[model samples]
Target: MEKPRKTAIFSQVPTLEEPRIDANILIRLLQVAIDRDFEAAEVALLKTLIQDPCLNFQAVADKTGYQMYYLRGQVGPRLWADFTEVFGRSYGAEIGKRNFGDFIHCFLEKLSLMPNSFLQQDLEQHQIAQIFEPGEGEWAIAPSESWFYGRSKELDSLGKLLSQYRLVTLIGDVGVGKTALAARWTERFGAKSFDRVIWKSIAHAPEPDILLNELLQEFEVKELPQKLSEKMSVLMQIIKRQRCLIVLDSAESLIRTTAITALDPYTSPDYGRMIRFFAEEPHQSSLLFISRRRFNDVLRLSRANRAAATMRLEGLQPKEAQRIFEAHGLKNSSDWQRLIQIYAGNPQYLISISEYIQTVFSGSVQEFLRCDTVIVPDIVCQEYITQIQEINAEHRALLFHLAALKDPVHFDQLVVNLATSMKSQSALIKALNDLTEMNLVEKQQNNAILFGLNPIVKKVILSFPFIGGS
Candidate 1:
């Protein structure tokens, strides 16, 4: 069998060399034009266009392993919308894939003709959109906000915090949307507000030396420092010069818990030093550290330095939480508010529980709530288990005792309950404070301050093996 030769779409155009274009810039333009993050398929299609400006959809499928049908049907229209958005209606009016090559060529030539200053001026005037250039680090694409609800007030508070402090720690429980909020804020204001923006995740607990090297490289530093101290010095210099917004996510991974004691809480020493440097050093850049718990070093530094601050993220409001259920196609029930309240308005939990309800109760919220017991989704429970295991036994015992209680209790009640396990009242108070800081416990102020566990947290604790499974 003889295969037909594939033809170049650009062959019909004039014989001129293709203009070189930075793919990252093109990708960012598409993202901003469409006001959403590009999915894997969309990214693949763009890469294919950039790699071979003359290739048709058939050739693109061969090169990128996407179905030609999908390239034309699903990916094509969306991309054309982005094109229409970035270019004009004329550029995207045609539906033929053949025009893709022309689009690329035209876009590249247009980019070349514009001066850098003109582009900046246009960006500032909001005539043309631009985003932060990728710096040295793992630059994560900001997640889509299609289903993101609420946090308007938090966003405003975050902006004020960044303006006032050089280092801001966003503390929240697992699945409480800390990372989402940070990414959203950065997406909204990072380019306009700072010279450079970099996102790094310590989810794998990368050592301080490795993290520093990665950050330094993001700034295009060619001469690598061999010593940690030297790396810190070089990074401080770069940050002082360039107004950078560096986000370190999953920062709780940097805290060491193996040797944690009632009196002495331990954080990774190098990580602590780096945090202290960011908190204490005079720099134009800002660092946003997102963690499940407030690091002891951050606590101490925040007390002494006005340049450091911490914001604890709570769950969505009732109305906002209802949107999750509505989006999930769950039936409206009077108990929807009850469900949201029990879950502490946590988006991840609500999403997970909604799926459970869909499968187990046919998407009937009332039916799901009929069981009367708070059903902590397995995924949520697993996350709680991982976090609880990392805390000291004293903290765990305090949590367990709180979980056993029927209602919120005062501090004096907790002191009496855990007196035998804890050495002194001071130790018990510290445990309460630490747990509260971690977002694992809640503090309610009425006639007097009362402490309690979130419903989900209490449910998880009751099921613990040591607690003999409620």
Candidate 2:
């Protein structure tokens, strides 16, 4: 699989490869107020508009206003009638009562700030001013629109986890769609039930003290006591009263190709304090810990042993993959199967390749079946990898090799190839197990280890100049 020619096009000086979008396509994001339950959609729409005012289209604004006034939160048919009247054009039958969800989705999508050369020629060239830059919305209630595709089961599982326990551990690898699942769950379930949902990514492994301080900041509490014990006391008191759902992302120190380094310094004793705070304090609270590492590191503290439900995401199924393509407006049953065979259910990779085939490659879904192209490792994966500073060169090198091999390799084969990298067999097993927990790889009975290789990943890997590039 060679890297997608599109990536190469992007790499070349922009003047060299043509851009795909117009310069003046910055229509404001739709701000149709919805039932308060749809807060996530409203906030996201508002932020998109504020950040990319160039997308502010008069027609879109009018429709959004109508939605705020009349239609239920999601897009509906009446909006279509308004669209025809305002824009002098109408598409999609029965506009008065069509799915507002789809309309709002398409509307918001068109507002993306894609600054490409091709787009420049299509529209006008004006800068999106930063004076009113958007801020990160409160813990994400709605998963990004991509999750709206085909993942109902995963979202259902998440709702169950939330119902059973206060602490949930969303364990999955890069691009496995853990965050998306949580977002969907929070939107559908939280909107109807929970009092509040707070999303906080523990950016990196900083000293426990510094990390704890930031956690307190999320609560808007200033001037903490210097003594660790006092701060811990204050934190617990505040948490006990609120019915809040907390997501602590990347709680461990398992660095990967996509994780960023943090600046936290927790002494062994303080580490105990930190663990106790999460596990023992906040007796009536619920929390979720999302990370790439397996449970051993988190569970080792003993505090987490009595709490926390776990949800590990897997690759998509063929049916779900097909559903995603259809939602994206593709209608080829045969090609859908081909896509599943190639991508093996990795959502981000699937979406990336799909985008390439659509907007960049002339909208022919079949082109993907006929060609081999590598895409970026997904924004999620790339962001996760940048957080790892402790993953040294040797371990990283071993992972690179392991990623190259097909899964279910016997332990003997792995050791023959990677034993030299580690000091002993125990260490190797731990390392491999860590990857498994990360959802980056899998292991099974009979001492066999498997690596993550969905169709899109394999395609991307093969596209690279080197072998096993994914």
Could you say which candidate leads in TM-score?
A: 1
Candidate 2 whole-model C-alpha lDDT, 0 to 1? 0.49
The residue-by-residue lDDT of candidate 1 on 1-470, one tens digit each, is 32212211121222226455456556655565555677788888888776654444555676789887798689978877655555444232232343455455544444444555544432321233222222244243333222357899999999888878889999988887887788778766877788887777777888788999899987879989999999999999998988888888888777665454333443456776777888899999899889987866666777886768999898999988987777556786677998888888888788778767765676788988788778777867887888788777777878888888899999888878888889999888877877887788999998999999988889888887553222
- Candidate 1 segments exceeding 4 Å error: 1-140, 143-146, 258-266, 466-470
Worst 10-residue stretch by lDDT in candidate 1?
A: 3-12
TM-score versus the correct structure, for each prediction: 0.69, 0.60
Identify the runs in model 2 with alpha carbons over 4 angstroms from their true place: 1-143, 204-207, 217-223, 250-272, 297-305, 360-366, 372-374, 377-390, 403-408, 444-470
Q: lDDT values of the candidates?
A: 0.72, 0.49
Over all chains combined, what TM-score does candidate 1 have?
0.69
- Candidate No. with top lDDT: 1
lDDT of 2 by residue, 1-470 (tens): 22111111121122212333221121221111110122443433433333332221222334355433223345323333443343222212222221233333433332332345533332211122111122333333332333445677778877776766656677766666776677656655664655556665565556656766876776778897787777777767766776667766655452333322122323234664555466655456667777665444345433435555666777788877765565344545677776765555777666665655654444467775566544555564444344322444444545566557656467667677876777777766765655555444445554444444343333333444233222
RMSD of each: 11.5, 15.3
Worst 10 residues of 2 by lDDT: 27-36
